[model samples]
Target chain A: MAYSEKVIDHYEHPRNVGALDKNDPGVGTGLVGAPACGDVMKLQIRVSPEGIIEDAKFKTFGCGSAIASSSLITEWVKGKSLDEAETIKNTQIAQHLALPPVKIHCSVLAEDAIKAAILDYRSKRSPAKAAE
Target chain B: MTTATATILKSLAEDRRNAPARPVYLDYQATTPLDPRVLNAMMPYFTEKFGNPHSRNHTHGWEAEQGVEQARQQIAELIGADEREIIFTSGATESNNLAVAGVARFYKDKKNHIITLVTEHKCVLDTCRHLEQEGFEVTYLPVEKNGLVDLDLLKRTITDKTVLVSIMGVNNEVGVIQPIKAIGEICRSRHVFFHTDCAQAAGKIPLDVEDMKIDLMSISGHKMYGPKGIGVLYVRRRPRVRLVALIHGGGQERGMRSGTLPAPLCVGLGEAAAICKREMATEAEQLTMLRDRFYASVTRRLPEVFLNGDEKQRIPGNLNISFAYVEGEGLMMGIKDLSVSSGSACTSASLEPSYVLRALGVGEDLAHTSLRIGFGRFTTEAEVDYAADRIVEAVQKLRDLSPLWEMAQEGVDIKSIKWAAH
Candidate 1:
């Protein structure tokens, strides 16, 4: 399948690829997908005191689409508030990357990673608010 | 290991700035480009001599008939068969169908059982499945871990009711060559007709109908650098192997496959067969060297990369490998400039892994990461070197991003960890 220029760009020069300290209270780490299923993405976001995402980093084991999806999301979620980041749906990621139907799961995983990372960060701040 | 591969390819890339933008074609198992000589032989038949081979009255018919008959002879010669035994068909899929279904249906009254390998092409497997619906029993025999069919198991599976034994000569995905000679001997002793799908085997390897004791064999034109839409089914004439015609009309191909034969395709196949016969020795040597060179270099630089099939019995042009901790599709993407196929079913319409590799007992993780890198007669050493470097580079890059690789490096048993469902 022909990857879109956006996917090619992200795959060739992926942004924010690294690991964050999972033990940090302000850091939320989302490890979603599986190696057996051919994709496993670790997306982490460090939230500031005011609820803004201070930084986002990701590492993914998957096809170009999966890596590109996670890489693209890391760029998208930074500086956004926790609530605003939660609004980042998979469709928007899919559209932004022009991912094909076969690679749509990559975008879904990216969206899930964002939410999961946000949840991890929120739980550290206020355990009662982590119910969602 | 991944870094080493990338380094090799990166250096090669520096020298290939002016190279063609298109990815190098390495998936020869899928199809091969037509040889220029074959094209030259076919050009006249396409324009000047476009007459139906079955037409009897006109000069146009005679010319077309000559082309078709000559092609039939050329194809027959490749497999050491008489010209009369060759039947033209649409392609290997149809040829396989005619052999599997046609043989079983024709002998259903006396024999209702058929035996085939698990690694046979989808067409052969699906055809046998269709026959099962018709009440004909089929034995899908398992292959050894090396991807070779068990001759003893095949012998034990044959019963008095067995009419046909269908096995592929060389696997398309792994390129392991089956023991056709031994299998043929067992089939012959048991009075069961032996049919081999030689689509991937035809011009790449030497095949003789008499020496192998094969009753029916399928040959695809396009796989051997011939034109598409043309194939040959070599039915044994000495023992008189008969199959119920799959396509019935106009009594063409001895009433086996009835259709107007394309003269150009016939001539192209003929020329291709002749060229293969003449160049098989040198081509095989060159391709084998190139294939091994690529394999040795990749494995030398890359750790945790495994070859999928038996190294010794495999086709010289095939080099299937699995890069641990990296998905095949992702690796393919990392090396977008190189054309290859992943064994992972995700690359296909289905989400399952390759059945062919699964038959060899390869783990699901390895299967998902496998790539089928095929070399051909036209492949150059430069291309092979470039491909090896690019693959290494991609595998390294993908591995760098893989969480599993990190765990493996840290001595963690990845299998023991429970993965999150989402």
Candidate 2:
């Protein structure tokens, strides 16, 4: 199947394709998807004290759709507050990429990665509250 | 940089942009382009000499019948069999179905067991599945890591109740040539019928029905650069291999396959077989060199690449390889200009790795990352070089964006880390 132009764009020139310092307090890493399923995405977000996402990066081992999904999400999540990033649905990403039904799961993975990364960031900032 | 160098780079970019957008053809295992000579031979049959071979009263019918008989002779000569043994069908899939299911059903009372490899083509396996439902038992034997059948295992599997043993001459995905001679001898000694699916092997390899002790064999036309929708099944005449008719009608093809024969397709397959018979030796040598060149060039520049199947025992035109830490679909996308199929192409819609690789004990991760690049008689050295460079470039780009690759580069055992239990 031919990939969409937007998918090709993201795959060819993926934005923020690298890892953040996972050990840093400000960096929250979310690794989702499974290798056996033929996709594994690692998305990371760096949050500022003002609860806004300062930077986002991703590394993905998958089809073009999955890489594009993660790359597109990294671009979308940056500069948005963690709460605002949480509002981004997988459907939006799927529509923006013009992904086929078979590849919709990639967009879902990206959305799950966003939520997981936000939770990791919140827990790091408030460990006692997270424990409760 | 000098202005001359900058200008050269700009022109190169422009040339690349203006280049033809078609991907270079490399998936020969799937199908091959029809040979021009074969087409030329079939053209007359399609136009002026159009007639049903089954019609006996007309001149048109007589001419068409002669064409089909000549075709039958050509195909039989290539395989060293009598012309009377050749039965034409739609293609190898139908040929296999007829050989497996037809033979099993005809001999169902005397023998109720059929044996075949797990890696046989889908048609053969599915035919066995259908037979199983009809109360016949089947044994699906596994291959070794090199994708070769074990002779000792075959000897142990056959029983007095086993009527037929069907194995393929060459694997479609991996291209490993099975030990056909050994299997044939065992089957002959045990008084069992031996059939081989030679769709990928007929024109590419040397085959003799008598020497191999093969009772029935399947041959595909398109695979050998002939027209599609035509194939041959070689059923031994001396010992008279019996098969229940799959399609019963006008009693064409000695009553095994009953249908009106397309004279043009029959002529095309004949010409193709003749060409293969004459040119196979030199063509095989050229293909082997080109395939190895492609393999060597890619493996030299890329690290952590593994060739799947037994290299030495495989056919000349096939190379199945796995690029570490890269998904097969992603790699194909990265090298968009090269037409290659993933090992998973057989079950691509299901997102599963190839059963052939799985039978060989290949890990799911590597199997998912595997690509099958097939060389053909038409492949050139220049195209191979271009494909190698593009593949290497794509793998590097994807690896740069792969977290697993990064971890491995840093001496981290990726398998040691617990993955999400999705």
Candidate 3:
């Protein structure tokens, strides 16, 4: 099957590749899944004290589906708040790429990574700040 | 080590030394080196035994005719087909075309839809596509990742308009075996003619024409230590199916394909089948063990390699694997000592990755990296092991230089990283 042009785009010159320091209060890293063909994604968002994502970086291990999903997730999570990123659905990624049924799991993985990264960033903050 | 094969390579080397300008013949799947014994059996016909059984006027044709009959019987016995059922053609492609086009054209008025799979040999796929262009509605069934057709899909796809279904017995690239018997039974019940391209499996596997309920099947001579340019199409006489002729003129092959038969090639084909009948069991067993050994060694030495197809349900002589980072041509260039193919022999020269692998949901990168290693009657255990080592080392060396491997090493989930399109 010819990869959808979007998949090809993400496969070459991937956006937001490399690591974010999870140790910094500004950095929240989300690690999810085993890297055994099931796409595993590590998304990190550097958040401001006011709760907006200031920066994002990600790494993905999987097929074109995995690559495209993670790539789409990184793009989606960049400027959103923690709650906003959590609201982003896997369906959106699938719909964007027109992912077939078999590769839908890839989008789901990316959505999960976005949530995990937001939660990672949220857990580092104070309860008062979270409630706010 | 088999003494027979150990000496063959040396003889090959001797020939290379003597004639440095000769073209190296590596296209084994297209045909094979005819055994000397088969050549001897056929030689008498060219000389004193020359005769046409059809010519009642003289002994020359009669003597030549006896060899043809004997060879026919041998071929029929080889596939466990009835003697009257085996019809000869120029090669497997012709046989395949006849089986498909013949049935579709015969039932042209009654049925318009034909079913075939995407992973079939080019001949079968092309014929189906050609039929489609001719206004026959064709449904190309998709194969699963392991290269086997989903039976439920087959059951669901057949309708009154469906006149036939053709699926290859053994995939030429991935080496996966389809469930032909189950499919044949399904088609038989549906009254749809079932055909299989058995070019790779005819001599390698146990094929009984009646047991599978196959309506038509294609076989090639060169695939099984036989001479090239001769093939067999097994047309079951039961219930009487009809296929239109692809070629016209002489009224040979029961008016299906009319051409002057290549006597020597046909005789060689029959002899090849006979030899396969006598030696298949032992040869298959040996090849399986060697293949297993090769896979184990290669996969162990190089971690994270992908073995394509249903590992358990493939031909005993075939091992196809996709090394993660190294491309096929680069690895092949590194391992120059051994000769093999990257995909189906017919399409290897094209820069495009095989259409068969693409149908299996394989991406372009991994698909191009695939290599098909086939062990024939003469491939010895030592060669398999040595080739395995060469492959493993080449993969390792290539991986060392790859950025993909570096990412995997750094615990960087490359799958999570969204890559941009090139």
Give me the candidate number with maximum DockQ: 2
Candidate 2, A20-123: lDDT as tens digits: 89989999988887676688899999999898999999999999999999999999999999899999999999999999988888899999999889888888
Query: Which candidate leads the pack in TM-score?
Result: 2
- Candidate 2 lDDT by residue in tens digits, B323-357: 98999998998888888899743124566788888
Q: Better model by lDDT, 2 or 3?
A: 2
lDDT for each residue of candidate 3 in B290-381, tens digit (9 for 90 to 100):
77888888878888778888878888877777776555654565566667666422122233567887788876657656777777766667
- Residue-level lDDT of model 1, residues B1-422, one tens digit each, is 24444565577667678675778899999999988678777877867788888899999999999998999999989999999999999899999999999999888999999999999999999999999999999999998999998888888899999999999999999999999999999999999999999999999899999999999999999999999999999999899999999898888888898888888999999999999999998999999899889989999999999999888998898988989999988888888788899987664445678999989999877888999999997899999999999999988888888878877997988888788754
Off by over 4 Å in 2: B1-21, B345-349
Candidate 3 residue-wise lDDT, A1-132, digit = tens:
345778757755467876777689888877665422323467778988888888888775445556667877888888888778889888999989887776677787788778777766776776467557
DockQ of each: 0.53, 0.55, 0.03
Ranking by TM-score: 2, 1, 3
* All candidates: CA RMSD (Å): 6.6, 6.8, 10.9
- What is the iRMSD in Å for candidate 1? 1.9
lDDT of 2: 0.91
Off by over 4 Å in 3: A1-132, B1-31, B50-54, B343-351, B416-422
